[model samples]
Target: MEKLLQTVRITINDKLYVKDPESSDLGKRIIRESIKMIYEIGFESFTFKKLGTRIGSNESSIYRYFENKHKLLLYLASWYWGWLEYQLVFATNSIPDARLKLQSAIEIMTQPTEIDTAFTHIDEVMLNKIVINEYSKSYLTKEVDQENKEGYFVIYKRLVNRMSTMIKEVKPSYPYPSSLASCLLEGALHQYFLMDHFNSLTDCSIKNTPTAYFKHLVFNALND
Candidate 1:
């Protein structure tokens, strides 16, 4: 626990420096402490008074860094995505083969490490709420332009394209489209995590676990 706290402190310091390079040492300390507090209490339950007390600074001092709670949460979400992108890129870069690349991506996505587990839980709790709220609203629904929709599709499409390229190398005669590969990966993840119930008739077991099922899907995708 001590080691984890030290690591989080270091990460907070690094992030604070990146965001505000000119900030004083004292300012960085306060920001780092505030982040630690947020990780413990969560965004919804975190209070200005509690943050101030933890950092040994008043609410006014904290406000200098962020205008409001919503703004802070937005910044955190952007930072979290940036970190995830870095990890994903690094994990995929090591495997020379396409099949291995796809396998590595699935493994990374489904299995959360100790550090990832902490951040993932917080992100799902906070960001998922915001996403659900926005997506549920009529105004927000209409506001999603084609470009933004395409951007979201691009992430999945790129993964499929990479897998397809690899599959071609392995078996040039394979008939499955990149879209189908994408669907299989996405569907497997959704069913395993987001689905309310795993239909036993399909021989799928929630008890079988995400990593096990994900590996099965990857193998089946490559085989077919």
Candidate 2:
């Protein structure tokens, strides 16, 4: 009995060591690699087979981690949302003054990370198609039921709420509504990046560096 227990303990320790040199490393690697592939190929063109090949794993192995492609996409989107939350929290942390917090929040929204530019034009085309198709299907399926509405809201609305809260904190006499502020911010970004009119309006120069234009818009909006 004593020999059996010793052998079992040794086997467990060996398994643990082999499985993770540090905890959560394997999962992090999976996510990181998955994001890289998704950004390169876009979600529509990105297959689990390709992802598995890139990550040096089998399709079955990825399936063990994620039930399906849709689930994997959701996971990626959720991870992005979490990243946005972290940025917001970090930006607001040092700004005890509400105005500064608001400025930082706008800055966070306008500034695209290095990860953003890693995607090629082809990647953007494929990804936009995939997202639009998914969203259309979800709308048709009435997937925007009450519970899921909150989830959608959290994706973008929460950022607006944070900004609104900051505005209220800074200028108690002139409080901004969260919904209105969110609409303006979303409109500005969507108009600049996704709208066709932007090309003709800005002589194509602003299109080259949309992030900078986005930051300018945010600053202008705040000043207005």
Candidate 3:
């Protein structure tokens, strides 16, 4: 999988960035350091000037890549989703059994993220934490509809549709596959959030894993 991903390029929406970060060393550094900085300090506290100081580049240079911090966050979120979608497609596309295929997709979506060494500049694990902690900031806004129309979320929506198709494969007669799929994806994030900040609100812990809960919920819901 590592070798396969070494040749793979996770594409982000072009509109999300003023310049493509993967196109240059400086751009890559911006992405790499931005992830590190955002992971260290929450997004609300993150700034381009701080990133510029960390990377030893002028703040205006950072703006040459991303118009603003909000666009930067959108770029990051889109990149993460694109990366996960590639993993999902690669892992489950050849599975012959419907139930097992659906289960595998669920596992990929719900399991704890590990660092993907394939992308040297980005840390998948920390990006997952950002997604869990700050992804809502990317879309929870009045401009979300316009962004959606511009396909800012196509990768994420495509991922959900992939899972939804897998669900239908598992249970041809079942209704609500898309709903179930979206729930599994979003619910995993919510459960992880609860486990991290509001332990009493959720049963998922280091041992009880959101992966296990979602697998159980999905399979039972599919009546497998």
Report lDDT per candidate: 0.51, 0.51, 0.92
Clashes of 3: 0
Q: TM-score for every candidate vs. truth?
A: 0.50, 0.60, 0.97
Model 2, residue 102: what's the lDDT? 68
Candidate 1: residue 163 Cα off by (Å) = 8.8
Question: Tens-digit lDDT track for model 1 on 1-224?
Answer: 54553343112223222244124665556445545656566556777678788767788876676666544543443344344444556678867887677677666555433354433224343342232222223123453465245342243345557556655665677777465556554454454444334454344454666667767865786586
**Ranked candidates, highest TM-score first:** 3, 2, 1
- Encode model 2's per-residue lDDT on 88-124: one tens digit a residue: 7866898787666766776665543433332221133
Candidate 1, lDDT over the whole model: 0.51
Model 2: CA > 4 A from native: 1-25, 115-141, 146-157, 170-176, 188-192, 195-198, 201-224
**Cα error of candidate 1 at position 121, Å:** 18
Q: What is candidate 3's TM-score against the reference?
A: 0.97
Q: Which residue ranges in model 1 land beyond 4 Å of their true spot?
A: 1-35, 115-208, 218-224
Q: Output the better candidate (1/2) by TM-score.
A: 2
